[model samples]
Target: MKAHNSKKVIQYSYLFHKIGILDDEQYKQIEEYHGLKEKKKY
Candidate 1:
């Protein structure tokens, strides 16, 4: 269950990153804040 939620978060983050909504640093900060273990390789 937790893994599913994390995957959704990652998907949203990736979409935001691609759309220029969030910069690289901001994305990293969000991932860190969420304690995401698997970092997406832009």
Candidate 2:
């Protein structure tokens, strides 16, 4: 269970970091364009 949770954390972190590659303004624009406040949770 511990290992599984750690893997999830790593996955989430990597995903967010990948998204972070976009410029902040672009990201914000995307969120607003999509009417989202944050990334959707699975």
Candidate 3:
């Protein structure tokens, strides 16, 4: 996946999680699938 797209997905997922729209498990799945969570400065 492109880094740009992955970054957006991560950002949006975090927003959803923060707003109570997504649970921890779902947020973890999205983060893992996106593979950008490993980058500390992404």
CA displacement after TM-score superposition, residue 42 of candidate 1 (Å):
24
The list of candidate 2 runs beyond 4 A from truth reads: 21-42
| lDDT comparing candidate 2 with the true structure | 0.51
Tell me which residue pairs clash in candidate 2. none
lDDT of predicted model 3: 0.85
- What's each prediction's TM-score? 0.63, 0.47, 0.77
For residues 1-42, what per-residue lDDT tens digits would candidate 2 score against the true structure?
A: 544554565555556657776655655554454433223322
lDDT (0-100) at residue 42 of candidate 2? 27
Winner by TM-score: 3
For model 3, residues 1-42, the per-residue Cα lDDT tens digits are: 477788799899999999999999999999998874446435
lDDT of the candidates, in the order given: 0.74, 0.51, 0.85
lDDT of predicted model 1 = 0.74
Per-residue error for 1 in candidate 2, Å, reads 0.1
